[model samples]
Target chain A: MSTSAAERAVNYVILIVFAAFALAPIVTVLAAALSPQSGAESAGLAGLHPGNFVDAWSEGEFSRYLRTSVLVAVTVVSVAVIASILSGFAFGTMRFGGSRVLFYLFLLGIMVPAEAIVVPLFYDLREVGLTNTLWAVALPQIAQSIAFGTYWMRAYFRTSPPSLIEAATLDGASPRRVLWSILVPIGRPAVMTLTVLAFMWTWNEFLIPLVMSPNGDFRTAPLALAIFKGQHVQATALLAAAAVLVALPVVIVYLFAQRHFIRGMLEGAVRE
Target chain B: MRHQRRYLPYLYLTPALLLFGTFLLYPLVRSAQFSLFSWDGLGASEFVGFDNYVELFTDEVLRAAFGHALVLILFFSVLPLGLGLVIAAILNRGQVRGLGLFRTVVFLPQVLAMVVVAVAWRQIYAPNGTLNTALRAVGLDELTRTWLGDYTWTLPAVGMVGTWVQTGLVTVLLLAGMGRVPRDLFEAARLDGAGAVREFFAITLPSVRGEIAVALTLTIVAALKTFDLVYVTTGGGPGNSTTVPAYEVFQRAFREGAVGSAAAIAIALTAIIFVLNVIVNRIAEGREE
Candidate 1:
């Protein structure tokens, strides 16, 4: 594993160059977001300003999309997490008939893309008068989230100790109490990873919202951005600012819990 | 009363199963059924009996979309994997400065929303965007054009964005795999006068075979299931040059009302992905032999 200083220097140079390639577009867009559109490309960062964001925000009206995104995200996370925890606990602890088959049945959800079900799903939802509503978006995502969520939580639950369950049962705690009171508390890291992942997946989800909630009344940020971009393709500076605005929350979340996010991705890769 | 405990698992599973059945299972079953029928989503249905599947096979546009997605695999999986191997080797083979910072910077795109990424790349590919500007500065002005708008270059251009987003993912994954390589093997290889490149081919590459398979699976799937990126940036424009199966499926079903063929394309795309997953996993697990 030992190497010469010169070799290490070469490695650093290659690493730094590729790293710049990775980040150059991001920096350029951010710079463009800050620079006014009046300046030519050769102007070279002169006449930079923050007014584009203000202009994009007022013009794009991302506030509504943000609200819908938060609502869908919160609803999907809480509902799916609870269901996954319960089902995962049962699958982990009990010898139930047809459990293995049922587990695989749900795993099918992850294997299939939104394209597969979305076409017919729109009809089913419309027949029930739920199309163009947040519930239409929220319901399918809850199902999608739980599909992966159950697998994640089940992996954690199977590793939980039997003695903890026994101790809780001996204390006369109900099964639900035993889960929320004992095992859920112990499985905090796994739950957090699952929560963040489900949040990210549902928040960044575009296809479902694109199909299910075509009405502007219930659309999320990414969808709004697409619609916005179509209408204002010429507004480069404003579009760049809107792009940054849409990405800000996710970047903030990544900066805070990157370790968990990356860990979840690596572990999820094998199961995936 | 004592026998009721036998139903506890079912009780716990009921909520998840109900939702999964209603939302996931039922809809998939319907897509399969809908593929056999010619219905405009709102009118009386006419059963066409596999006509849609036949059309899916014969359709030239659908085939091009699939072919374009395959080329994207080159950019999304093959190119990134090669790039990943190099960078991961450098980062792991020696003590590099700020490895953590470099890793984070490289992976930043993967974390950003694809919508955001598509929008950013749209600007970078614009006529007067950064790449052209740089090319001008370096006297390589002839090499510049509107990247995502040209019919010939649009798919590759879109694919390059995929490459940019996926490289860090593959690198981090390969680096994680490389960390698991036995230390003594490298030392022994080096002591035997094996050069760095030779050591990499002999030791590092062979050992991280499973990680390579995993990386291929994830990125291949991403490339195949690419909808939002294409949707946001090109919308399958420039005369269908940038179209993919996912985008085509959406257009056929939602836009053109070809419900039967749309369902057929959707199922075909899913079948391709599923087959790829099985094959990739087989390769990943086949190392046991």
Candidate 2:
């Protein structure tokens, strides 16, 4: 495994090259966002102008959209995590009739793409007078996240120590008590991972918000950003600023929780 | 107490079941049912009986959309895998400094909403955008065009965006997999006078087969579920050159009012995703044995 100096230098060179490739577009957007607003041509790092974000923010009505996105992400993550815990606990620990079938059914949520269900789900939600509302967006995402969440939590719970559960049960604790008081506390990392993932997916979701909010009443940041792009086609800097604004929240969260996010997603790949 | 015990699991499962049934399972079935009819979202419809499914094969645009998805697999899955393997192998071998920083910068794309990605790239590919500007700067004015608007270039342009987003994911996955690979194996290979290429193929490649399969499944699925990018970037435009199955589903269902056709396309897409993942996993598993 020992590397010669020449080979080591080559490795660094290649890694740096790939890193630049990955970063070039983002840096371009960031530089443009900071540059003075102009027409269709990219300003290309002229003078600094921070007002573009303010302009794009108000003009695009991003505060409203971001608030809507936050609302949806929070609603989906909290509910999905709680529900997944219950179902994951049941499937991971207890044996029951149709558990195999039931687990497979949950797996379908992960396997089936959003495109497959979005159309009918749209009509169905509209039937119940739920379309165009934020819940219409949050509800299906909750269901989808729960599907992955249940699968994820089940894996975590399955490997949880049996002795601990037995110890709690022998002391006359109820199953629900055992979970809330014992397992959930010990499952903090798994829960954190799930929370971060659910939040990311919900925040980034485009199809659900687009389909659910035809009237534009409940557009999320990303959805609004898209609509803004069309209208502000001439304002390249303004568009870049809007893009940065939409991306800022996720980027901030990711910087703080990158380890958890990376570990969870990579582990997710391995488990599959 | 015994009764409570018997139903306890079901009770715990109720919330998940309700949401899953209402949103996912039922809609999936309803999509299938809707595919069998000629309903246009606002009408009492007559049964078409597989006419929509037949269109998936016969319709030029729809067929092309699926074909474009297949082409995207090269950029989105295969290219990234190739690049990721090389980058990962190099990083793993060298034990490079600042690995964390590199991973963060690279994986940033995967975290951003595809809408954000599409928007950023939209500027990058504009007529006087970053790409053309750079080309003109380099005195390659003839090479410059409206990349996303050119019929011949649009598909590749959008596909490169996918490549950009997915390469980080593939590299990180392979790096993690290779990290677990025993150093002794590499050392033994080196003792046997194996070159780096020989060592990578003999040791690194075989060991990370599972991770490679997982990477392929995820990226291919992302490629197939590409509505956000196409919608935001080209709007399937200049022509249907960049139209994809997911985008077409939206166009047919919402824009064109061809609900049945959209439903059929969605179902077809879901089946393709499922079958492809299964094949990838089976191949991975077969190789493992």
Candidate 3:
């Protein structure tokens, strides 16, 4: 099982090449964002400069979109985590008639692509006079996220020893207390992982917001960037700049929580 | 005591059940009902029975969109799965240093908004963009073409971007699956005089079959429902060449004001996805058995 020098060399070369191919587009976009000139003409990797970033930021209304995106993402994650915790604990610990059937029904939400229901969702929201509001976007996303979040936390909680819950009950701890004290604390890593995923998905979601809020004022960062590109079609530098701005937060979150993000997604994949 | 405990579980599940009924179940039923009616999403819905479904079946545009979606499955599902398995095999060899760095770099695309990925790739595929420049620099100018605009290449070309974005996800999943593969089995094979390639096929591939199936199912689902990538890149341009079911739904509902027809398309898509899911799950279950 000892490694050979030739094998090690080959591995390094393969890793380098694959890594470059993976990272190239991101690096290219970042470089383009920094380019000075803002036009349709070819920049050829030479026009890159810092000044384009400033222009992209100021001209694109990126700050407002970033704020809206943050608000939506945070709210969705917060609500989803709380709801998933309650539901996951409920499904995991409690035993009731038809619980298995109900849990399976919830799994349908995961299988049915969001795009399928978006039309009806739009009409429902509009009928309720909630269109163009942040809740319209946040509510559906939270609803969509709950299935996976519940499934995730249910797995985590099921694996957790039931003795702890029984002990908490024996100590006269209320059901709510048992969850907050016994479950939430122990499930912190899974909770954090879910939060990161929820945030990433909500922040990057495009179609729902784009269709729900066509007005310029309510646009999220991703939608705004899409619109910005269309409006400034001839401005490649600025478009790249705008794209970088939109992508930065998710990239930062990913870098810091890379392990959790990957693990959470992989866990979801295998379990389902 | 068992009965009391069982009731307690349902009590706990009440909130999820309520939400699922209201949001998930309700909308799905409502959509089915709506598909039988003609409405502009704002006006009175006139129920017309199965007319919408009949029209959708005959609609050339809808048929083409499904065709494009099938094409996208090749790009988004088949290619990514193949390339990602190779990458995962390479990384799983245990000789790669800076594994964390490589994984992050590969998964970077998954984190970015599809809007950003589409836009960035659009730039790269532009007439005189970086891809073309690189092609020319390497004396492949003759091979250079308007990748995103070309009718023949547009769907596959866009699907390639999807492949690029998702390959990292497949690789990461397969790597995790590969980790579960016992090193002893590999060693035993090696001792039997099996080469690396032989060992991989005999030991590694079988071990990760579940992961492969899972990855393929997820990628195929994503491919079939692909919209944002096409929306941002081509907007189903060059004469509806890249249009897919999702885009068709968007167009029919929003652009064409045919909510009933759009709902029918949505229903059809749901049916397709459901059948696919059942088939995959059955296959996975059969394999496990």
**What is the C-alpha local distance difference test score of each model?**
0.86, 0.90, 0.82
Query: lDDT for model 1, on a 0 to 1 scale?
Result: 0.86
Tens digits of per-residue lDDT for model 2 on A10-101?
Answer: 98898899999999999999988888775434444355778788889999998899999899988999999999999999999888999999
Better of 2 and 3 by TM-score: 2
Name the top TM-score candidate: 2
User: How well is each residue in B159-187 modelled by candidate 3, as lDDT tens digits?
Assistant: 88988888888888888889888888878
Q: Please tell me which model should have the higher lDDT, number 1 or number 2.
A: 2
Indicate the docking level reached by candidate 1.
Answer: medium
Best-to-worst order by lDDT is: 2, 1, 3
TM-score of chain B of each: 0.95, 0.97, 0.92
Clash pairs (backbone) in predicted model 2:
none
TM-score of each: 0.96, 0.97, 0.95
Give candidate 2's whole-model lDDT.
0.90
Cα error, residue B19 of model 1, in Å, equals: 1.4
Better of 1 and 2 by DockQ: 2
Q: What is candidate 2's TM-score for chain B alone? A: 0.97
State candidate 3's DockQ: 0.61
lDDT of 3 by residue, A1-272 (tens): 55688877887887888778888888878877776574445454454577777778889888888999988898888878887888898778776667787788777777777777788888888888887988777777888788788888898888888888888777788777888987899889999999999899899898888877756556899998988999988788789989999999998999999988888877676544
Fnat of model 2, as a fraction: 0.80
How far residue B220's Cα lies from its native spot in candidate 1, in Å, is 0.8
True contacts kept of each: 0.72, 0.80, 0.60
Worst 10 residues of 1 chain B by lDDT: B1-10
